[model samples]
Target: MSGPVDAELARVVRDHAGRLAASLVHLVGDFSAAEDLVQEAIEAAVRTWPVEGIPERPDAWLYTVARRRGLDVLRREKRHREKLTGVSWPTEPEPDDRLRLIFTCCHPALPRAAQVALTLRVVCGLTTAQIAKALVVRESAVARRITRAKQKISDAAIPYRIPGPDELPARLDEVLTVIYLLFNEGYLSSGGDRAQSRDLTDDAEFLAALLHRLMPTEPEVAGLLSLIRLHRARAAARFDENDEIVQLQRQDRSLWDHAAIAEAGRSIARAASYRRPGPYQLQAAIAACHAEAPSWEDTDWTQIAVLYDMLVHLAASPVTALHRAIALRYVQGPAEALAAVDELESSLAEYHLWHATRAELLRELGRRDDAQQADARALALTANPAERSLLRERLNWT
Candidate 1:
């Protein structure tokens, strides 16, 4: 392939492969089978595109080809008849292939990890490397996990259609979690020194916005929208003029996007109007506490502490608990916060955030030497240059 042709093929593959795979999984009723079929289709495309040029509806073409290839494999393996009993393919293509696929991959029958990995791979178009990085696992580990997930999808006889309203509420959490993780991975670039992780943020926004549009009355959808929009408002300020990391307290608030902040407030208010609060809403509320504060001193650490307290009940994650500790120190004073931190020290021993928070709390309590040691420990756990740089700078403050 020539340089331009290869580049074009790569672009098309990157852009549409995941969506195609999702559609195929929906059609074929097996995530693993769908991945194999999609890869086979892309191989065909690589050969065809170099000769016949690119097609107009490459994504649809991919979906069509992958589905056919999947059927062929099943037929050759003599499982087509049994698989045919499981699902009835439509004579005509559905209008919302991607949405149908999303619902299928997020089916309540699948394990949470399988749902997340499949969604990140097929819906978000992330490579195994990127997905592994996002999940903080090795690439080979992610590959093996994905392979097994697909096999389980086939063996467990999972359906390939959107669920009824009764199943929607229960399945919605996994979907939202996948969307949030995708956004965060993009925002932080997960495990990388790359200048930026594209599409991770964009795909997240697109998925969140699509959900908001599809379920206009769903408060949780609004909560997720608010969470992503508000967090992204400061994405610009997270890095400095030289692309180094800047602490949230030190970030130039002036550089934060007012428009994104406004949108977040709108979503948060919309979700609040529903009278049923959720994790995203509570987290967005905490973010709002930070965004609305005129200065670090003016920050509503007290309210943030309250919000985190609520979040602990809603989400029950150690990360949230650690965050709450930081806010508690600011509100009830360092001693109470240190107590809270110590309670979580064992749970968060390996998390960089824990050490960073521990160091800050120790410094607040006038234990400079211990605080410095904690900061160094925290820095040691970091792989992100921006975060590492920020932590190192904090160490020099001693």
Candidate 2:
């Protein structure tokens, strides 16, 4: 408790660091330069906090210092002439560069992997080592990638503005995918010891909410919000006290968050009103069905299967097919599910969920030994200890 003060102080510093970078980069149009401003601002805070105490708005305070440091950096380089009195920079914060600062970090022009890392680093304020760990890469590799990416972006003169209407479609999909991909990592981690990467989930939700504010009327944005809310409503029941994975039927319905469920309902209605019928909207509908059902027996498996079928057609990813197969197992029975699973085995060989689902279906069909073996294979494949433990528990059912 004695040192909690320092922790709180650190939080204040970290919270404003990304915004500091965003503003600095917008003013200077340089990545490493903006980061330097943030570092200097942090260093200043560390030195000043014990002397001046925390300010009323630490963020505003950080912005002031970071801006000054940025100006100082410019002055040192003799570049202040760009802002001669007749052509002085505006006193108001540059919202356009701030927007582009985030968009560029997750820009579709960059590789998806690069987008994820940079978003976490520049926008989420994560350190390169933390980002490397999050992405399961070595710290040195992450450091090099970050350096190269920033240099390339600055060299290529990636514009610092939101996409225009003509350029929105392709860029938007990549942005949405990266956001959801981060959320997925948090919801049900594809790797690591934790059952869910709460940090990643929080970051994804933060970005999605930011996007919703930026594009309020956009149906796809509403779809993503709805989908995340509906899924998050079930978070309380995703695992049990023993940390075992709680299958939907076995989960406690009373634990679901009614407020979040209602929010998701409003979002779903908002998206459906658009009549766009995109992937996120369809997925939200599936979530809505599960949320609306009163009990396991009352759940609309048929409707969910249909949604998955639609998703398979639209996205055509192995992940979607895997979900559709699981839904079929519920609606059409284990034999049908097995046939669907068989189709995904080759492409999804490393996908632990696919193996786990197949094991369950096989067990339900009285193929005990095969079920046990499949479960074992899935347990071996997952780095998530929580998921692995859940698979082991399922194996015991054999």
**Candidate 2 wrongly placed segments (more than 4 Å):** 1-19, 39-54, 71-75, 80-96, 190-198
Which pairs in model 2 have colliding backbones?
A: none
Score every model by TM-score.
Answer: 0.78, 0.86
TM-score of 1: 0.78
Query: Lowest-scoring 10 consecutive residues by lDDT in candidate 2?
Result: 81-90
Question: What is the per-residue lDDT of model 2 for residues 88-112, given as tens digits with 9 covering 90 to 100?
Answer: 2233454445457677877766777
Q: Candidate 1: misplaced stretches above 4 Å? A: 1-35, 40-97, 107-113, 127-140, 164-166, 190-192, 196-199
- Deviation in angstroms for 236 in model 2? 1.8
